[model samples]
Target: MTIEQRYQLAKAQYESWGIDVDAALAKLKQVPISIHCWQGDDVGGFEVNKQALSGGIDVTGNYPGKATTPEELRQDIEQALKLIPGQHRINLHAIYAETNGEIVERDQLKPHHFQNWIDWAKKHQLGIDFNPTLFSHPKADDGLTLSHPDQSIRDFWIRHCQASRRIAEHIGKELGSPVLTNIWIPDGYKDTPSDRLGPRKRLKESLDTIFSEEIDSTYNLDAVESKLFGIGSEAYVVGSHEFYLGYAVQNNKLCLLDTGHYHPTEMVSNKISALLLFSDKVALHVSRPVRWDSDHVVSFDDELKEIGLEIVRNDALNNVLIGLDFFDASINRVAAWTIGTRNMIKALLYALLMPNDQLKVYQEQGDYTKRLAVLEEFKSYPFGAVWDYYCERMDVPAGLDWLDHVNKYEDDVLVKRANKS
Candidate 1:
């Protein structure tokens, strides 16, 4: 059958179940996923004193053609964004600032340090998100930042986070959108610590200091991320999930949930509703974990679909901020971004096409048998037809046709970098 014929059939099938396929597509188009910039550079940012990645996080493999400069990374991102199906924003780490050959310390950074990025984003008509780089520095070599024992070290990180908030506000004001400033510190111990409370107390105090200056909500929103464990901090993580949940609620901040930052058995989809009940907003770092925090490329797997369903079913699309977070240096960096982002949009489209209201009615009416049967039947729906139609509407190559664009770009752009080096 032709693509239009298949979409017509899918539309009829969905309408029979009281679903508005067009409305779903409209909603999906409005939700913007924030694409992480680290994927293009393998987390190697352009800084005067670029330190090796440390603090319990590291990227594996040595993929050739990894972006080594700000211009190259932006070029790669532009290529990837072309293949993605929906509008999106770019998430930037503080380490990615362009200093123009000047030595700028993290704590002393200002909005001007990232003026080029702001201008580039403006040209592309994209919103910008910000993160404080708390790792991969001399001070954080000991697996701690805001929670460090030394007062001077803790103060330094506090200042860096404060500066990051200011930068985020500046970007938001320039772009006319609220920039999400997420703070994730790698502070913990490899082994059981003698004084657990001390680190957490210090962390809380440091957070208070960083957030003391109130910026307009229209300009910037604050989020605190927590991790269950890391490569080195297996035994203890200072900012546990509980700690950040409480902190977010107490401070009226958004809590960030990184899919790989939780236990192996824990799925972040289950925590969305609970967190949203108390917090006004919840930010997500969508990633795939292979038995551990590996930061694999996101796939359109069961968990991803569930995460999308949770957001759509709860009607929390605006309240839940979705973003991609993964770094796999083994594959083509541009392909990694393209594949992960397309899959993320695919998952959301899948959720949008679901018969959520019917399922909810079944559950509320104590019709478990019907609910199970309807849900099982939904698996066979013509979701691919709808996805293809959406991609076509968005003016992006549908199906695997996008792969040709990535391959062509790799041949013309990425491979040349390797040959030159």
Candidate 2:
């Protein structure tokens, strides 16, 4: 049968499965959103599992050894693009080996290295989502934790902020894309809270220095307003820090709605709404929220089913960049890529199937349960509706099937269990 006819049949089958068939099918047919891949830290270096272990780049350690040369990196990205089409991208780090828990100069940025990487990505036609202002970089030896009382340490962070702006302007122009600098400082209360007001003010002072005076002034400052609020148990990143950094930055700056980077009870929609109010260009980094940690997993779609629909119906989905924040056993890179891609497709499909008018009513009247029902109905839709709709409409990996991948994972888990027994 032709693709259109197949869609009609699938639509019918979806209705029979107790889902809102009309709305679901409508969502399925919409233009698929572009998927951006996060090029995790260099996979070339030594992988330290617990204590110098080389199994893979999993959750525990931050060391991703250098396995791919610049040329190889370009080739792998090219291969991924062919495997999965659409405006594909990967997050690029400006400074190499800058976050390896080592001491180094905080006042300088290597422009030549950044320029070379940008050229490489341009040649490959892949876009970059730059993660600047990261405290994990090597220059943050004294730590970007403003709570550091020492004058010299605070001075280093100030220098680091200046360096960040220069690098951002340099790379943003070369890449020709609005540089999305995700500012997530690992600076938070480890035990009891420190001088919250003083440290944060200093941090903001540092940021203000960059926002007001850093950069080549003329470069397009399409800064992505990003911040992390809390870390682990009881520790907080404080509003003064997140707000000053987010608002103090210039306008036209997009805010990155990272899934796992907020307090557990915080509402995701509220966060999105706040950013939407401030900037026209909003972006997202989608991931599963693990207990006290960012799991970087394919988030269970059920979590945001209703809220996601509301956001879309309100016309909020138009100018958002949805990026996948994922990680797996370094050895299981391909598996992570496959599953992460599927999860993203599912999220997009969920947004599409929602009825704009009905969702608006739910939002207007505060009928959360009604909104939730819409999502649950979609979830109950026929299994193959997503497969048939997305696989037919968009450009996905040729032979990669989600059902088959899950089955294989299950088989592997069972075998491992049996061996243990």
Candidate 3:
């Protein structure tokens, strides 16, 4: 059947349940998903003298045609954006700064170092989000950064974060949108630490120093990300969830929850409602973790839907800054971004088409049976038709058609990079 016919029938099905599918599409279009830039190069940012990735995190598989230059990465992102529906923002790291063949220390980075990015962002009309590269640096070689034993190392990272916020501010001012400058450090111990409080205290002090300068929220918003463990710091992570949650609440900073940062049993989706109650805003790094905090591509799984539902049902679309955080070298990089990001958007669309008000009433009236029944019924509903119509209407490829575009682009663009390199 034609996409329009399918959408009309699906709209009727949802309308029967008192759900407004068109309104849901409107809401989904407004929600911007910050696409991570690192995925284009497998986190290999264009630093003059590059350092090996040192965080507990690692990107496996040696996929050829990885972006090696700033322009190339942007080109790959451009291709992916065409395939994915709706407007979105791009997430960048400190290491992505262009230094013009000169070695620039992280602390010494300035707004000019990223002017190329700012100019490009303006060209595409995409807002840019920023992150301080705490991992894969010399100072962090020992798996210590903000919580390092040495005061100098801690001061260095603090300065870097401070610089990052300024850069974010500049980007926000240029793009005319608020930027989320997130800080994620890999400072933990391989074995059990003798003193956890000491590192956490140091981390707290460093954060305070970094955020000492008052930048207007209009330009930049600061967020601290927490992790349970990593490749090296399996025993303890200094910036634990509890620590960051307390720090964010006390300091009025946003706490970034990476889906892969929690334990297997603990779901980041479950924490969304709790944070919304106290904080005015919360940030997310939507990712899929397998057995470990492995940054796998995000899938349209149950948890992803729950997360989307939490944001939509709670009326927190504006309050929650949704962003993606995953790197899988096993498949096409551009396809990785397209697939993961599409799934994220798809999950939200699914949530938007649900009869959330009815479900809430069922729970409130102690009618669990109806709630469960309605939820299962919608699972088999004509959700795909609505999704396809949204994609086609947005002028992007619907269904598996997007994969063909990525494949063609890979052969036409990405493969040439590998051949030259």
- Cα lDDT of all candidates, in order? 0.92, 0.51, 0.93
Candidate 2 regions off by >4 Å? 1-5, 11-58, 61-68, 97-106, 136-147, 214-234, 238-253, 304-311, 362-375, 382-389, 402-421
Show how many residue pairs clash in every candidate, following the order shown. Answer: 0, 10, 1
Ranking by TM-score: 3, 1, 2
Comparing 2 and 3 on TM-score, the stronger one? 3
lDDT of 3: 0.93
**Residue 127 Cα positional deviation in candidate 3, in Å, after optimal superposition:** 0.6
lDDT of 1 by residue, 1-421 (tens): 8777889999999889888999999999999999999999888898998999987777998888989899999999999988887788999999999999998999999999999999999999899999999999999998999999899999999999999999999999999999999999889988988998999999999999999998889999999999999988999999999999999999999999999999999989999999999988899999999978889999999999999999999999999999999999999898899899989988888888888988999999999999999888998899999988888889988889988998899899889998888
Sort by lDDT, best first: what order?
3, 1, 2
C-alpha RMSD between model 2 and the true structure: 7.0
lDDT of 3 by residue, 1-421 (tens): 8999999999999999888889899888888899999998889898988988878878998788999999899999999999999999999999999999999999999999999999998888899999999888888899999999899999999899999999999889988999999999999999998999999999999999999998989999999999999899999999999999999999999999999999999989899999999899999999999989888999999999999999989989999999999999988999999999999999999999999998999999999999999999989999999999999989999999998998898889878889999
Q: After superposition, how far is residue 312 of candidate 2 from its true place, in Å?
A: 2.0
Least well predicted 10-residue stretch by lDDT in candidate 3? 53-62
lDDT by residue (1-421, candidate 2, tens digit) is 6555666776676555344655654554442333333333222321121122121123544322212344444443454444442455566543442323443354555555466567776886655555443444343432344335676665665666556666766766786665555554555554567466776666666555555664553443434333343333134454332664355345334556666666667656566666676666566666667664354556536655544654565566556666666554443443455556555655555665545566567879999998888756756654445555556555553234544643454355423433554
